[model samples]
Target: MALFATMSMTAGVSPATAGPEQWKIMPLGDSITHGDGSSTQSSYRADLWRILYPTHPGLDFVGSQQSGQLPDTDHEGHGGWMIDDLRAKTIGWIVAFQPRTILLHIGTNDMDRGPEPEQAPQRLGALLDDIEKAVPGTQVFVATLVPSKKAAVQERIDRFNAAVPGVVAGRAHVSLVRMDGLDPDLDLRDDLHPNDRGYGKMASLWGAALGG
Candidate 1:
């Protein structure tokens, strides 16, 4: 529950000097954020940019890590990372990037490789607490994980996703965006990752959440 994020902030580009019209958005999550199943590996970030950039010309995606082939490839999407991993680094990334908006889609790994699925919601809440404390004004959008094909994994996913709204409740800047209607048999490329079409669907949902 540290209020201020303590980090050097020296490694990346200098602190953002965004103009009044510009908005820096950070996509913070796992491989889905990294564009794992997409052919272009741009993930939903690229498609999201395409959706929002025309109207919101200054919509900038910022992060330490880089992937994809798009012009704005920056993001904080780490593959195989859990909610706690993101929690540990959230403050540092916030301090470095100074994003005004954060898109968080996490906890898939915890559900996939865990003995305890019930605790993910609490961990997610803790991460949100840190984010709210680090920068209270920042707009946060929390999305439920996309569907999975495997019955056992999907069951855990269903339970975890079901608790997300409750986790995000009462956080003034945080909003819940449900990723429903994505068929695992059709949308997913692998067990858990989304294909290009699925990423497009995700981008559409994120775009709607951002009011684009």
Candidate 2:
């Protein structure tokens, strides 16, 4: 990842030029990261831009491609992507971008279409290991799956989420973000994706996890 992200114009102002961009933040996931529920294209990313940059100066969002209506149009969100898909591409992108940090929320597709529902967390662990291999010191914040409506889906989600902490524990440059209580009816745009308000909530959770 590039050291400095090309900052987008926000609140009618360009990025500060005090120095090169210090932090590169990548929102890597499935459709949720693709901004399916939010009209502003990843309400979490949009809201993160609106809220975080003021306090966390010189932070730039980086990715292989850009999306969203915001001036900073970069991310690695894909619709219906499974952990395997992410596993294949993640390291390459990490090497290309050399990001300082990555915000990862994946495995939803695996819950919906399981090759083996039990292996999701292991795949996640492998992905994290790949990141450490590719980027060495990059930080990763992995989110547990948010709430879902169906009983079976939620059960699978719980199983996958339950395994996440153990996989992340004792791991360098990786941590878990709990999403067990995030409401589906309240935040979800559909059975899966988060609505604008939901994405805002997601953004708040992510921001809080990032810890300035």
Winning candidate number (lDDT): 1
Question: Residues 57-152, candidate 2, lDDT per residue (tens digit)?
Answer: 678898876778875879999889999999999888888887888999999889988699798888888888888977788999999888778778
TM-score of 1: 0.89
* Number of clashing residue pairs, candidate 1: 0
Q: Name the 10 consecutive residues with the lowest summed lDDT in model 1.
A: 1-10
- Can you tell me which runs of candidate 2 are displaced by over 4 Å? 1-21
Residues 51-126 of candidate 1 have per-residue lDDT tens digits of: 8998888888999989998879999999999999999999999988999999999988998996577899999999
Per-model TM against the reference:
0.89, 0.88
Residue 76 alpha-carbon offset, candidate 2, angstroms: 0.4
Scored against the true structure, residue 73 in model 1 reaches a CA lDDT of 97
